[model samples]
Target: MAEPTTRPRDAALGSGPGRVLLTVYLIFAVAAGARALVQIATKFGEAPLAYLLSAVAALVYIAATVGLAVGGARGRVIALTGCSIEMVGVLVVGTLTVTDAAAFPDDTVWSRYGSGYGYVPLVLPLIGLWWLWHNRPRDRA
Candidate 1:
């Protein structure tokens, strides 16, 4: 039997595809967080649910970024969880906002499948999930 080769803990954070994914995740984290903050501070009463959803999305993005950058068993788990939640969020919010306008008076990060953000919000989580899966660490023999 052949022994499995494993990547170093710092490998994902160093460079290459992992680094690129991390960069993207960081961008989403920043953008989502900033937008959420502005919405909450300026006029939370206008659309509390949407603003809160944005904050949750931002936190998920941040977690995913950290997981990708960390590159380990724990990181994989965190990234997977975050990505899954993000996917669900985008879909649910997108559908609700479009089908029921009364509930969502304002836009959220996932509103209309991220139309406001050029759909980057919709695509980012999928890409992050794919990257994490692709860079998954090999099991030790």
Candidate 2:
């Protein structure tokens, strides 16, 4: 086998549009994490479900941000999983909060399709997925 070159074979994941995605994920990670922490610390008893969901959302955002920053095939897979879960979480949580606000009793980052966050949470995953796909490595001719 030929010696491998140190130069990057593919573009860095965080290059170009991925940078924007990474920034968004970072913002979400911090925002959601802080919110979850405060809610859990200040009033867990009042809305355990919502607060727990908030923590989960924060974790997902953190994972996604890290994955995107890491780059490469493994990172893409990790980010893909995180984005998929985030999309589902937002949809399910958004619906639950909308259909029956009584159960949640509080808002999470995903509440109302991320209405609190200007619906960016609702749309971020889709954008992330597209960015991943757009940047997927292809066989060199």
Candidate 3:
């Protein structure tokens, strides 16, 4: 029997693209989490749903960052799940905000498809999912 081929260790961690993605995920996680914290602390009553959504988005970003950093089977699954949730959240929240503005007095990260964040919040998940899929480990036959 032949040993299964595996990716080089350096290729997994030191890849330029992976580093960039990790950095972006980290930044988003921190930003979203901090903003949610401030919102919840100062005025949770103002828009509870929106604030909670922000927190959720922050958490997903954090998970994505961890997944990318970990880079393995478990990590990929985590990242994939996060990305899927993110996509759904953005679409739902964005539509709600636009179609029923009265329901959302305050802005969440996904409000208006992340318009306030230059649509990065909207696009980030797609990018993350794509990256994860691209880098997914292939079984050696």
lDDT of 1: 0.85
In the range 66-133, model 1's lDDT, one tens digit per residue, is 77766677878888888889899999999999999799888888999999989987898888777766
lDDT of 2 at 58: 97
Q: Which stretches of candidate 2 lie over 4 Å from their true place?
A: 1-11
* RMSD score of candidate 3 (Å): 3.8
Report the alpha-carbon TM-score of model 3 versus the true structure.
0.90
**What would the TM-scores of all predictions be?**
0.86, 0.90, 0.90
The number of clashing residue pairs in each candidate reads: 0, 0, 0
On TM-score, the candidate that comes out on top is 2
- Could you give candidate 2's per-residue lDDT for residues 1-141 as a string of tens digits? 999754233336435676777998999999999999999999999999999999999999998998788877777888999999999999999999999999988899999999999999999999988887777888779
Better of 2 and 3 by lDDT: 2
Candidate 3 lDDT at 67 equals 77
By lDDT: ranked, best first: 2, 3, 1
| Per-residue lDDT of candidate 3, residues 1-141 (tens digit) | 999976534227455877887888899999999999999999999999999999999999999888777767777778888889889999999999999999989999899999999999888888888787777766679
List residue ranges in candidate 3 displaced over 4 A: 1-13
Give the lDDT of residue 105 in candidate 3: 94
Global lDDT scores for all candidate models: 0.85, 0.89, 0.87
Model 3 / residue 108 / CA error / Å: 0.6
